[model samples]
Target: MAQVYLHTMFGNGARAMQEAAGSRASYARMEANAGAADMLTDREADFIAARDSFYMASVSEDGWPYVQHRGGPAGFLRRIGDNRIGFADYRGNRQYLSAANLAADDRVSLFLMDYPNRRRLKLIGHAHGSDDPATIAALMTPGYGAEPERAFLIDVVGFDWNCPQHITPRFTQKEIERLTAPLVDELDRLRARIAELEG
Candidate 1:
C-alpha cells in the first residue's frame, strides 16, 4: 500500500515522462495517500521466511550492474529485526564480485520470487559482509550444509509487492510433490482395489 518504493525508483526524468502522459498527478496522489513504514509487516516477514532464494543486484565501480542468485535451504534469509534481514554468505565460485561491489557501494536490491504462487517482492537496502562470529551465528542456519565465510546484513530501506500479471506460474519439485501427494495416494488405493478384484 506504500509508494516509497516507487518514489525512490522514479527520478526526475521518469516523473517528467509520467507527467507528459498525465499520470504524474494520479501517482502523486496515490503516494500521498500511501502509508509507508520503515519496518517490514508481519505478512512480509512470513513471505521472506518462506523464500529459499533471491536475486541480489549490486553495482560495480565501473557502473555496470550485476545480478547474482543466492540460494540455500528455506528460511536461510533470517529477519534479524523489524527492519533488517541477514543471511550467511557461504563460500561460492570465488568470484567475489558482490563483496567487492558492496565495499564500494552498499546500495543493493533484492528480488524474491514465489513462482508457484505468482508472487514477488522487491527489496532495496544497504548490505555489508562481515566475518564477525556473533553476526555469523545470528544469521546462519545450523542444519544448512554450507560453511559460511561471512555474514551478510541487509538494512532494508523499503520493499514492494510486484504485480503478478506476466509472472508465469511455476512449481518447484517440493511444491509439485505437496500438491500431488493426495492424488498419488488415491491412485495407489485404486490399484489395490483392482488387484483384489482380479484375485
Candidate 2:
C-alpha cells in the first residue's frame, strides 16, 4: 500500500507542489487511509523473491543521494523476518560508497523493476551492513560465484507499487530465449522436412 509511502515522502516541499497542482486534498486522504506498511504481505514477498536486481539509494553524509544497482540470482534477496530482508553484498569496485553511507545513516530506498511486465515496486527501509558469516552465508546463493563482503539487511518501513505507464518493455537474454523456443523447434522440424524431401 502507499499509505506509509505517501506519508513518508509527502514533506513540506512535496505538499506545496501538490497544493500548486491542486491534488493535495486527494493525496492527504490517501495518506491517512487505513493500512499498515511495516509488514510484508504475500504479494510483496513473491515480488521481492522474483527480483534478480534492484536499485538501492542511500544518503551521503553531505545529504547527497547515492544510488547503486545491486544484482544477484533471483530470490537471493529473501525475507529474514516478516518485514526484514537482506542480500549478500558482493565485493565491487571497492569504493565502499554505500557501506560508508550506511554507517552514517541507515535510511535507504529501493526500486525493484519487472521490465517485461512494466511493473515497479518502491521501498523505504532502514538498512545496515553485517559481516557475520552466518548472515552472509544465509543470504548467499548456491552455485553463485560472487565473493560476498557482507550482508546488507533492510527493515522495510513502507512500500508502494508504481503505475506501469511509460515503462518500455524489455527482456533479458534468458527471457528472449525462452520466448523464442517454440520458433526454434519449428525451424528444426522444417529443416528436417526439407532434407527428407531432397533425399
Candidate 3:
C-alpha cells in the first residue's frame, strides 16, 4: 500500500519527515516514565468567589482549537457537584466559536485569572450544552436577563493552580496613575483658562 503524507505551514516535506521521526522518539522516552502530576489541588470554595473572567478552549472537528472569554459577577463559576462545574454563557455577537467547537468535541480547557490577587485556575473537563430551565437559571447573571442561547455544564477531570511567579502583579496605584495622568493634566489646564477668563 502507498503511504499517505500530510503537509503543514512549518516547512516542506523534509520537515514533516523529521517531525514524524522526532515525535515517535519523544513518545518512546515519555512512555518510559510516568506522566506529570495531576493539575488540580483542593481549594477553599471562597477562592472562586472573586473571579469574574475565564478563558475557555475547545477543539473543532478538524482538530483546530478555539478559545473564548466569559466574564461576569463573582462566583459566576459554580460547583455543580464534585468534579463538575457550571458557568453562564452570556449572549454575545452571533459568532460562537466555543459553542460550535463544544458541539463537535466535548473536551475543553478553562483558565480563570483573578488579577487583583495574582491568582489563576485551570480546569480540564468534558462540556455539555443545555437549555433546561433549571440549568439556565443556575447560570444566569443579573442584567444579563436569562440564560443565553446555550450554556455549558462541565464534568471537570482536573483542576490546577496556575503559577503566578511569571506574571507581574498589577497594582491599583500604577493603574490609576496611568489612566488618570492625562486627564488630570488636562483638567489643570482647563482650570487655569477659567481663572484667566474670570480675572
TM-score of each: 0.94, 0.95, 0.63
Q: What order do you get sorting by lDDT, best first? A: 2, 1, 3
Q: What is residue 14's positional error in candidate 1, in angstroms?
A: 1.4
What value of lDDT does candidate 1 attain over all alpha carbons? 0.89
Per-residue CA lDDT of model 1 for 1-199, tens digit only, reads 3577777777899889999999998778857754555469888899999999999999999999999999998899878898899999998999999999999999999999999889999999899998999989878887888889999999988788888999999988888999999999999999999999999
**lDDT-better candidate, 1 vs 3:** 1
Local error of candidate 3 at 101, Å?
Answer: 0.8
Better of 1 and 3 by TM-score: 1
The candidate with the higher lDDT, 2 or 3, is 2
Q: lDDT of each model, Cα atoms only?
A: 0.89, 0.92, 0.68
Residues 1-199, model 3: lDDT tens digits: 0011011112456555756777644533433443332322236245655566688899988898888887777778777676677877767787878878888889888887766667777667789989887787777766755447766898766555666777666555656788889999999999999999999
**Highest TM-score model number:** 2
Colliding residue pairs in candidate 1: none
Error of 2 at 3 (Å): 0.7
Model 3 local distance difference test score: 0.68
Please provide, for model 2 over 1-199, each residue's C-alpha lDDT reduced to its tens digit, 9 standing for 90 to 100: 4788888887999999999999999988888784667468888899999999999999999999999999989998878899999999998899999999999999999999999999999999999999999999999999999999999999999988999999999999999999999999999999999999999
